[model samples]
Target chain A: MRLRLLCCGAALLLLAACSSTPDESLYSDGSGQLGGPPGPISPDGTIGSADLNGGQPAPGTQEDLELTVGDRVFFDYDSTVLSPVATETLDRQGAWLKQFGSIVITVEGHTDERGTREYNLALGDRRATAVKNYLVALNIAPERILTISYGEERPADPGNDETAWSNNRRAVTVVTTVN
Target chain B: MTLPRSPRARWLPALAWLAACLVLPRAAGAVVELDITEGVVEPVPIAITEFHGQTPAEQKFGRDLADVVTADLARSGLFRPLDRRAFIQSPAELIDLPRFADWRQINAEALVTGVITGGEGGTELAVEFRLWDVFAGNQMRGQRLSGTPDQWRRIAHKIADTIYARLTGEKGYFDSRIVYVAETGPTTDRVKRLAIMDQDGANHEFLTDGGDLVLTPRFHPDGNSLGFMVFRQPVPQVYKYDLLTGREARLGDFGGMTFAPRFSPDGRWLAMSQAENGNSDVYLLDLDSGRKRRLTDHPAIDTSAAFAPDGERLVFNSDRAGSPQLYTMRPDGGDVQRISFNGGNYGSPTWSPRGDLIAFTKITGGVFHIGVMKTDGSDERLLTESQLDEAPTFAPNGRVILFTRKDYRDNHIRLYTVDIAGGQVQELPTPLDASDPDWSPLRP
Candidate 1:
């Protein structure tokens, strides 16, 4: 018991230290024109938030795709139907994949903590399939894409509130090919 | 008769019962019918005396046996084991003659007395106990179990099971084992390994090394094997674990993500869910023929299949009707009937070994609950409410349920067992975090 408490304390310290650093999901548009993730509220309106990231992410990289065209689409609770915004994100993703034709991708489906493991696994699979189908309709080769469901296992946001859950219920397009 | 000679044998005493000298004078009205529906059951006050012994080691074993047996019966929630500090009649005095007056004076309705005799060190230990109904002034049960001293705890469980059976008229679940996924690390990158322990949370051993993530372990009816899911390179697949050999092999080539594996009650078939192209369906793998048959072809999640004790019907979880709910079908997947109709989403349905109840996880109002209902879907009773409680497995006797609870307090997932009536919940101990519990049948 003492050891477990000590480990928990150590983990808390690690979490405290890690939270200060920006995670990969903190996307910043190179021009900083968009108000979505990391920007639009520059303190003096002189420096674009992209300056915080030093420079634009390299083209054809995961960061580049995440910044240039979005790499994730969110889902509603217990749903696989793609919202219009999700489709817009997938369409951009499809065009990016066409640009980088040789790069293979894996679509990872995820869910919130509200469901059981087995059912959420299936639900996440369906969500991934939904994104994959949308991209396939745009003529992306099915052979270049793989889908895996993480269920609620890997949450993008660890918080349990509705806002956290909305972010967690998502399909993430990951660059699986070696550069 | 030859006894199983392996020192690691799980139940030498249970086997010893085959040749045990039995004497149970079941007096009229002695069997107490447990009011399982009540939230607070008036526990039967029972006094247990340390077994009498001649040698110093024997005396210690006697004391340890009493402690173990008392714990087992007390955890059942049907008996209130009297504090040993309050016993007026000493161990020697009780063994000489259990004075019913002394027992009744302490408000004890039942008295248990025993004596231990054994060889030294590596030999056998023979223990015997008698249950006396202090109210009726008659003996309720008497039995003897002999085993190696290493098997002392098993012997104690056997004695407790026998006493519980005599008093409650239902089979006892004490002398059983549980296989579950022992968990560690953060929820984002959890490490889960297959683990086993006594039902009372002793003698814990991890079967797998945690290199692969394991989930939902279900023991075969023979208690020698388990079927569970493992996440390997390509996808998650159902795998069978041989308890005796510590060997594991994939159950089938489902060609997709397969999980939620459960052994049919008869151990001849393994049912699991296989998802292909986002459509998850239930399939049965015949153990004898090495063939797989699809039970449900719906484009919804249909999984968590468990067979009734008689092996005629299977109760499973499904979302084909839009939301997750409990459903029952024949073993051949015909006669599908929807069983859960409440507003909440229900999943992880497991049929009781007694063929009377189906236990499941109900998600209502954002809180997960473990609940039970009759096989016909009536008389639903929720047993627990927590931030996250899923995948309930009934005890061997079907009187108790074991499930996993994600403790928001500690950010830990642990195993817990509650009575079917929803009282006396216990956090079963493990060396590490745990989840996805599966109780094994009584050792043969």
Candidate 2:
């Protein structure tokens, strides 16, 4: 009787995996393109239920740099200096880069909508460079890292308060390619 | 030239005596000279009558043209167009001769009269306008504009520019175009496109599809091309879009990101910021030679470089002093002097066309303000205060500034215009949410 119960549980797990596989593939292929149309879910009532952690990538794939390792590092107001927390995050990212030797990454610097657009662009550039520098110091190849500054154009949070501002001032590490 | 001393020219001798007194050194107790340095700050009251037209099509064009001129003048804040209801003379009556006495009774300091006629083949338009100084009792300006019927609006703006220049003794910015970023969607995943429109927000059209992220559309001094940045995933680069041909090309072959592009005063070179290995610096790219020269090599972030009107110097924002601040330097990036000292961060410093002041965005105590100061950092005046105001672009005449203001509640960004003297803040109407507006030099 115990063996039959175990077999039943295994079948249910397989069914769940089979049902979610198509949605996972759709997101991984379609939504991975920056600024592309979002993926569509099946009408199986799994919308917003499976893998809804802020659209994080699945594990073990090259895009999973954002999921398995960390993807973002936060900065203080009008500052590009890497904090202790930011350094810790960069350390993990550097290790991930070392393990995935063929994967290339782009560090996008962003700022909260506080200062002028052009200045924030420069600030974002500084933050992104700071992240790249930290990763390089941790033995990541400089040639594998690219940096861009979006200034205050792209915000992680759409709020105006301090919490949203803190979340918006971030440097995101994106996996660009894998050979 | 000599004119007969008729009753109409009766003020000639008095004006001559006044001119003589102004040109000659003053003697003791000479003519009781009055030193008048201050003038009226109120809007100059003017009346713009509906233009008289011969044919039906001409009439429609005339009415539309006159309405556009009226709106343009009213938006300047320096001119107060009297209501049409209060007009004492009709367009037909004013075609023969303006009733200056009637206009003066309505408190109109100036009067405008025009006549429109459909040209041969009904494809061309001929517009004639006369500007009369009502109090002075003289025709200040008279001109004719002929163009295709589709260009009726341009003809109207030309007339307004004439009147504006005559009365204010300054160049007009009405006959100009504004290139800006039109935004839509939520703040998190906003779609932005390059859009161009008349200075008064007419004839709006998108120059690009919202395929990739676009920002900071700046018009070249020639007014026929635009420079902006486009983001294509991992890289963003500056691009030049030719208005006449609708052709686009990358400004440089940089390996990394290049942004915040502005043309030189002569439209011969582009000043932009380039980022590599995480450090961004200002660079000047020669359009003719395809040569790139790094302007600033600071460890801190240095970008947003704008050439002065004379092209001998540049004003840019830098964080070398720990926070973003306005700085001015020679074109080759020497003699750097910090031009902002307020207890806040200053950024996006754009030199005025008149070369008297530099407009900038300032952030202090979590509030953003649009402010102006002399090139040497004196007479700092903040013209606007809000939760987020930035990217101030000066009008061609330097009497006004257009900037972006973000509503703190909804994070919706809109374009606003404020007078340099700082009184009323006027919101520019845009079909979509707009930001990063750059006013073109007065177009011919």
Candidate 2, position B101, lDDT: 91
What tens-digit string does per-residue lDDT give for candidate 1 at A27-103?
Answer: 42222222243222235633333443323455688877776687788888899998877787787888899999998
lDDT of each: 0.82, 0.79
Would candidate 2 be rated incorrect, acceptable, medium or high by CAPRI criteria? medium
Error of 1 at B389 (Å): 1.8
Task: Summarize candidate 1's per-residue lDDT along B1-444 as a digit string, tens digits.
Answer: 333323235434333553236575467865334554456778888898899888998899999999999999999888999998988988877665577888888999888898899836857888879888887777878888887787788889989988888777788888889999898877778788989988998888889998988888889998888888888878788899887667899887767898888888778899888888888888899988889988987878888888889989999888888899999999788999999987799988999999999999999989999999999899899999999999899999998999999877767888898988777679998899988899989764
lDDT of 1 at B290: 80
Off by over 4 Å in 2: A1-59, A62-68, B1-40, B119-122
- Write one digit per residue (lDDT tens) for candidate 2, span B66-160: 89999998888778889989998888898776777998899988888888887436465778787777766666677777765656777788788
Provide the lowest-lDDT 10-residue window in model 1 chain B.
B1-10
Displacement of residue B28 (Cα, Å) in model 2 is 25
Worst 10 residues of 2 chain B by lDDT: B13-22
